[model samples]
Target: MERFVNWSGSLAFDAERLRQPTSEQEVIDIVHEALDRGGSVRPVGSGHSSTPLAETGDTLISFGRMAGLVGADKSNGRATLLPGTGLAEAGSALAEHGLAMENLGDVDYQSLAGAMGTGTHGTGRELGNLSSTLVGGTLVTGTGAVVRFGEQADSAQGQTLLRAAQLALGALGVLTSLTLRVQPAFDLHRQNWMTHIDWVLGHFEELSQTCRHVDFYWYPRSDRAQVRVLTLPGDEPAISPPGYLKKDERGPSYEVIPNFRDLKFDEMEYMLPLEHGLEAFRRVRERVKDRHRDKVGWRVLVRTVAPDDAMLSNIRQPTMTIALLQNASLDHEPYFRDMEALFLDWGGRPHWGKKHYRTAPDLRRMYPDWDAFLTLREKCDPEGVFLNDYLTEIFGLQGAP
Candidate 1:
């Protein structure tokens, strides 16, 4: 039951006891056993994270073997599922019942629990992240106690648990199942293209406002992007894309197009803290073009998200995130230094799971409730079962066994 970790092709952690519990009782027993032996447990779902959220030095609980449509409520537009169920598989199953998730990330391979745990999302002005669609689920507490919570509950603890569970981080305990809100299945029409940074900035507001769902990618080495804008027809049953358009390639399905990785680009992502996203893009474009002057490759991509409290959500506010993929292999430190300066100037926050070289003090300034989040983690997982080297280096949380 052991396997090598394969999260986002970056780092790997060797695992012991990759348990796939098919029943809640099995999960409870495993938790109790771990507690008795003074061992820890980490629940892994699809290994899709860019961060080491699922890494544990003790036992690994993989949900892959415990998957399928558990139940659905057609009238209420709700579905309950096992944690290992893949997003696309669940989406298609829900579609057969005339239902779909309100939003989905670009990659469909992630499990429902893992996506919610990390706040995976897609672009839409009115829509929120996938975690927001979670109405309720069963959380096995750190003490191996099983509790069920949902949105419509009348109790105060239930309400608090529902909100907190939206981004539980798997620190609270193992999640056996989830109940998600669903919308009527709909068809999407997509358009893709390339544009100059100036034009994109000029119309960024209008573009974001107009589309039902829109996202763009600017190539690092080139002036073009495989941009896509999706729209749904009004007052009509959803129509499938024409055969020709449907045949269009879904470039690098699980990842952004890796056009200039060879450039040894040191990458940096800034969570732009402005409502009028176009202004941020315009500013970044001007600064980079004026300063670099053909010495670097610039690629600007735009995507949308609904807000959440995953601690790493880019759209925590009504915001836009503009990423700069620059050549860094030659002088990685200097390149990062320059990027960090500009990012801070833009009031940008780094993606918590990426390659930013910021320390805890720096991250504290970026997140308003950094200490409060730590307090929450302490309360939920005082034993530090979920702790890993990455967590220690980033947050400096010691005292875990």
Candidate 2:
């Protein structure tokens, strides 16, 4: 049996069984078998999520063989891909047809299904999350029913089904394939430099308005912020600075978007309302610097994202993301708990894939469409075969049969 461990070693579990499904029908059959055996099923991707959303002791499923671009319609700007395809592969495949995903997270290592299912997003004030690009997908429900939802929505049910699948977190079922809304290939002008923390907070609004993508790291101890900005490709006009202050990388969006990360750390991020962003950052920075100095080992990451309508998406409004990442060597619970408390007081919504402690009732108040998502989940998987302890607690689900 293969050992189950997350990328950061933050989450690990021993499962009763592991299954890899290669085709849509295979995924369906596996679901049927798991239900028959009265076992919970969970699908894992690159193990990139910091949360225990994927940890299950029974019937762990892998789509290792169910990967790659299955189809593409360049004229319609849509691409269908198997669930296990990685972000890097999806980018390359889309580029082949003069297309690209609208935006992508900094880490390009997550699987397409995993990223969308968890609401992974990139930093852009005018851009939506990865799930927003999910116009269609095929899912195998808990009862072993194979259903497909797509763009040419003939009914309100199909539209809601697609919306629910956007960020369902494996609660609805297993996603076999996804169809994304693609854009024409483009390039980016990425500029990065380390500046003072106060400088970043002071110019936050201005920075958000001018850049296509803006993200930064706040080292409260050093009182500095590593500010990075990506500008869309156009010869509009620019002045050059010395050495590494500005790197002009002009290529496909896929090539320029991701910042390769080698360090391993556990992170807790919250999606705060844009209006509440600055004050919340000030409070969290103070907590990191003054109250939790001994526990907070890594810097704070900040980014902005536009509104997305996915039923469970964290970015329900134009949101600002603040991630507190700590070295895996330290105890993150104390620091993370404190930070979450502060962010929540400011009306922040926890990123689904990151560390968060909010359960059903609190989460229900956060998302307006929460009830609708739960209704769909029940409708699709009454047996609760798709749920694990983590999901059950978070969703406040009834006891599994």
Q: List the residue pairs that clash in candidate 1.
A: 265-326, 266-328
For model 2, state the Cα shift of residue 350 in Å: 0.5
Report clash pairs, candidate 2: none
Residue 260, model 2: lDDT of: 88
Residue by residue across 1-401, what tens digits does model 2's lDDT show?
Answer: 45799988899999888898878888888888887777788999999999998888888898878999988888898999999999999999888888899999988999988999899999989999999999987888998888878674567788889989999999999988889999888888777866677666776687788778888888767777787778876732242222246445666788888988888889899999988888888888877778987656788889999998889988888899999988887888888887898998888999899888888889989888998898999999998888888888888885755
lDDT by candidate, in order shown:
0.65, 0.85
- The local lDDT score (0 to 100) that residue 383 gets in candidate 2 is 87
The residue-by-residue lDDT of candidate 1 on 1-401, one tens digit each, is: 46555443544677767777888898888888887888788887776554576777678887887687788888998988888888878877887777777777766877888888866667777778788888888887767777776754557776557766776667667778898998777666455545544444455466677776666766544544545666664422132322122222232112221121323334456666657556666665666556553555545556766566544344578656666655442333444466667767767776543456777677777766566667666666666666666675567665555
RMSD of 2: 1.9
